[model samples]
Target: MFRFAVLLLALLFAAPAATQSLQAQYEAFLEGTIWPQAKLAGVSRKTFDGAMGAKRLNTDIPGLVTPGAKEPPRRMRQAEFSAPAKYFNERNIGYITATGRSLARKYASTLASIEKTYGVPARILLAIWGRESGFGRVDIPHDAFQVLGTKAFMSTRPELFRRELINALVIVQLGHASPSAMRSSWAGAMGQPQFLPSSYLQYAVDFDGNGHPDIWNSVPDTLASIAAYLKASGWVPGRDWGFEVTVPASVSCALEGPDRGKRISDWAKLGIRRVSGKPFPEHEARAEGFLLMPAGRHGPAFIATPNFYVIKEYNESDLYALFVGHAGDRIQWGDSRFSAGWDRTDSMLRSDIAKMQRALEGKGYDVGGADGLPGFKTRRSIGDWQEKNGRTPTCWPSNALISAIR
Candidate 1:
């Protein structure tokens, strides 16, 4: 019986590779299936192979790509949103702002043209440039083909990866970029603007009129490409990213996100006030927005607009969206004060946060139904509990709190 069990375990371990085949088969497929797609797309096979041969499947990276498997969200706050609001003050703002302004100057002409053409704000573009690549300080390491191939070979979304892998090969064949030059993020985001191969094909532009949309090496092309993507994703010029505001003493707002836009007048009528203490502009009085009290009622709050949602398309997570917004906000103005209150403390791990969400829901507080995220309701409950128990209000969760509520 023990021998049989050993054999069963061996087979279980071997079964996945048996199902997917090894890297050799993957290589042959690249030569066979992928090359044909490239030829049809006007790429030479020699160029395809030579450009791609520099790198190999990064088995480690594919671990980051599988979908529907149990893994953390790509980004999460290191602590409760309230904890950092105080530290994200004028001194830090000064440091980040200087960096942003310098990057803006470096990309000024390209930025101006991109803004004129795409309706994305220049400061926002500069902020992204500064943040993602450190104003081009960082160098890309892995060739994109290997990165894409590794993900394709191991991804839960095999169809998506396969398509992207083929697209990378096709780009090589088109002479748009060599395999060696296609180095980028391990997840296969490439170039100055950090575009996916598919996105590069779709939205990247040759702003210099240099005949190639050279995002990898050309500054103008990359900024323009970034701008183009933002425009397509619904960036509105001249509007602030959104305002940090305090919710009114009376209105019961719930589960509103940047995705849920409500007119500013309507939100104001409900008692939302700006953090800066001045009234919201009349022109934007009717611009729809959703209330997001990030640290609960005791923490900081914001009214995120459609443009806020646009930044999320650039990156999916709320924290990433906040980073982009706050970075831009800091660049535009110095040391903006907190809009809402916070009971600052360390954050729960994402998995813990998920468990806490379940606990909170069972206790009759709605925490947006536990998709492994902390949001308004979850934060609010933490705040309410802390307020009631003299714990000084924090958005983070604890197993002890769960035990108490139970």
Candidate 2:
């Protein structure tokens, strides 16, 4: 009897059927969520089918990070950030810019009409379009359900994906798009506007009055829908996003967090002069904002507004926001210079950044150590050290960063 019981238990343990593999579970979830979303979004049935057939999760995309990977021997650490730009060279930027220009021209009438209808600036809308899909240059990699479903299974961001999946389903039910036609990034953002399904539900517009918010293929619809998002995000019609400014030598860039926000009048008093060599003259140049020095003293400086935060809603990275703002400026004026000064040298590698983060943490700095990359807190610590040592306060880590490891 004991031998029979042992054999039965061993058989049960070997099969382990109750816990499904991650891939199988994800596919099951995707099928259930995608179809309903497709119908509601009004994606043509054919478009839906094409996109669905082409869909697959991006399994090899790492967490979009590389913190603490061991450094390669005989390498300059700064190559990390700079290398990407090197690969995405001038030709790439030119192609990207031309694609944007073409899209802008294609939707010229709609953009003008939307600009008139919504007080959001035309260039800002175009900039968003340019960056998101590279004016539709980047391929839509995965269908909405599969991407979100995979992320939901594979990440700590399960709740976000779960909610997004529901929104995708809602889109199909509402006739805004179809399940198969809802193509987007692996993170689940969709359309030329790169809107999440929820954002599309709230902000997408049928600007040509075609009765469908066709952001996927309709140039007018996509451009106008972007305008609608900005307007709803509280874009202040004609106001500048912010201005490049030169700070007094005595001022500390470390003091430039969102917490230090003050009115434009307050900024003028602080000797924050514009790159234009004049005081800001528009949009209540007195509106409150915080200073931004992206690479500390080495990069351009700007006094940006709460509305700038709204654009960050479109994409979260400071680099992204700065690029968009600068691109907007470029559309208005060609390759205008940044005022904060740039380090032009490459970036520290992931392992180096992890080492730096660990060093900072060892000194009671409270930086979450060696996770993979340095963030705002780590940069602020560098600034603090620079100010103490009477250095330039560039916030970038250097050989000097290794010393005084607290």
TM-score top scorer: 1
In model 1, the clashing pairs are 43-173, 262-288, 262-289, 263-288, 298-341, 299-340, 299-341
* Candidate 2: tens digits of C-alpha lDDT, residues 161-257: 7667667766775677777688988677898899898888888888767777987877778887887787787777667778888877777777776
Runs of candidate 2 exceeding 4 Å displacement: 1-22, 27-58, 64-106, 339-341, 351-377, 389-392, 399-405
**64-143 per-residue lDDT for model 1 (tens digits):** 43334554354454543325465455565566678887767767777788889998887787667656676566788777
Task: Supply candidate 1's per-residue lDDT for 405.
Answer: 50
lDDT values, one for every candidate: 0.70, 0.67
Weakest 10 consecutive residues, lDDT, candidate 2? Answer: 64-73
Q: Estimate each model's TM-score.
A: 0.78, 0.75
